[model samples]
Target: MSNDFYTSSILPYAAIIIKICRAYTNTQEDFEDYYQEVCLQIWRSNENFRGQSEWSTWIYRLTLNVCLTLLKKNSKHHVTSNHLPDVVAEDNRTFDDESLNHLYNAIKQLSEVDRAVILLYLEEKTYQEIAEIIGTNPNNIGVRVKRIKERLKKILDGKVN
Candidate 1:
């Protein structure tokens, strides 16, 4: 049943999971671990689907929540990894352009919440949709997006930490 569900539901939406997980993790091993964990949580919580939103929207909210929760939990116990990859997590195939690579690399440095906001914005989601997914007031999204973009610009220009 689970395998069937995965094939029918999750496989089709795997790219979103990969994008969210890759954004949340630094190393390839951590990316694999985060992806596995997000899939597990999605499976475990499948029964709670209330049909209140599009299946894709539910997946996005779940992916973001799982990534944020795991990031917070992991941050408390910091461990330096000698095997860390030189480049911060970017799916080379997805971002083949040199400039996109730099932009995405800069994105990875953003606060987790900002990264979530910008990711949704890049997906062309409306402020209302982003607010709904992130569980915030719609009015706040515009301001947050402006700030996030400015920060990304600074990061790209080597102007800010």
Candidate 2:
């Protein structure tokens, strides 16, 4: 498929893509590498997209699958925040954004499956849709999201002090 496919279809979601990449990988280089890999994978698999879901949802599944597979195969070297560009901390003010970042950081501490659920939840995905993509029941997603929210709030409250 031509690059235009991504330019038109997937490029609009780059920020979410980047956030997901950063949430998984620590270093800028590693994140970029993984982001490129995701793009390539999406492009390669574009033709096979059977229109079973929204394109973004499909991309999210592909991204989660790719990142989880990579994580299972190789553990990335943990990097301190100093190594990342300052922008990682940008958009990180305001109670909600700060709370969201804290929540994201805490969510990163969970298993890959949990992390995916939290990310989808933060993205405002419905439990049914999240369940559909992750192959879990909607009821379980509801419970998991509630637990994730409580965990995030605890982390946020701790950081506020």
Candidate 3:
């Protein structure tokens, strides 16, 4: 994509990128690294976009794939982060809401695929849209989402780990 297209996409898509990357990362440093890597992948794959879906949907798939890829790669070399998880947004101004932080923390506890499902569901993507992005059947999303929501509730309520 052209510089202008990427630039414009970055601003509008910043929240999606941040939330997805943040969910997969445990520290501020790792979050920043994931964010940069996701953006880099977008830049590298500029020519591969086939316009078969909306730009936002395409971006969602790209962000999720990049994060998932990096997440798996890190597992082979996993090291505990020195930084505290709640301390992640201390220096960042955008996601400072207390409840948002709690929700994100709870989200981080979910299985990776469940995290992606809930993130897309929260974005208000239709079941079909989410299914397309995640390569699952549309009907499966509804059932998974229902389950994920219940799991998130239990996590938030301090009843489950």
Candidate 4:
């Protein structure tokens, strides 16, 4: 894509970029840094975009890879427990705004891969789409979503909190 196309067609989805950045960072400075980095990566890779998928899809995958690489290079403080149980107890549902905050917090408590899966799921991306972006099979994405949802419930129920 040309510079004009990128600025005009892709830059308009700034909110999507910000949301992706927020998923990858915990602070304003970190968020800004990741956001800028993702933008730069997108710009640098624009020439490699082969148009096999929707522009948004390509951007999403590229942005996620960029964030994952950066997170890998940084500290390991955000790594979620790998052995968290897949089963969760019932009767702990919180559907209010507090529930939303709890959801975000629980998301932060997940591992980087789990975080990416849950974030994309919460964003309402389909399993096939998520699989494409994450370079996994759709069936694997479905299974991971189920496991992550249970994990999130466990986190919200004070099991991991």
TM-score of each: 0.87, 0.78, 0.88, 0.79
lDDT of every model, 2 decimals:
0.81, 0.74, 0.84, 0.75
The TM-score obtained by model 1 is: 0.87
Leading candidate by lDDT: 3
Tens digits of per-residue lDDT, candidate 3, 1-161, equal: 46796678665898999999988887778889999998888888867999999988999999999999998899879764422355553443336587887787778778889999999989999999999999989989989999999988988787883
Q: How many backbone clashes does candidate 4 have?
A: 0
Predicted structure 3: lDDT? 0.84
lDDT of 1 by residue, 35-137 (tens): 8888898899988989999888898899999999888888789873422244543443336688876776777788788888898898888999999898899
- The predicted structure with the larger lDDT, 2 or 3, is 3
Q: lDDT tens string, model 2, 55-152?
A: 88888888888888776655554433312234554443213666566555565556678878988887898999899878889989988988877766
Every model: Cα RMSD to truth: 3.3, 4.8, 3.1, 6.5
Clashes of 2: 0
Candidate 4 residue-wise lDDT, 1-161, digit = tens: 47786687568877667766766666567778998898888878788989999888888888888888887777565554433333321122223466664576567677877888887887799999998888889989988999999988887888864
TM-score of the candidate numbered 3? 0.88
* TM-score ranking, best first: 3, 1, 4, 2
Question: Model 4 compared with the native: what TM-score?
Answer: 0.79
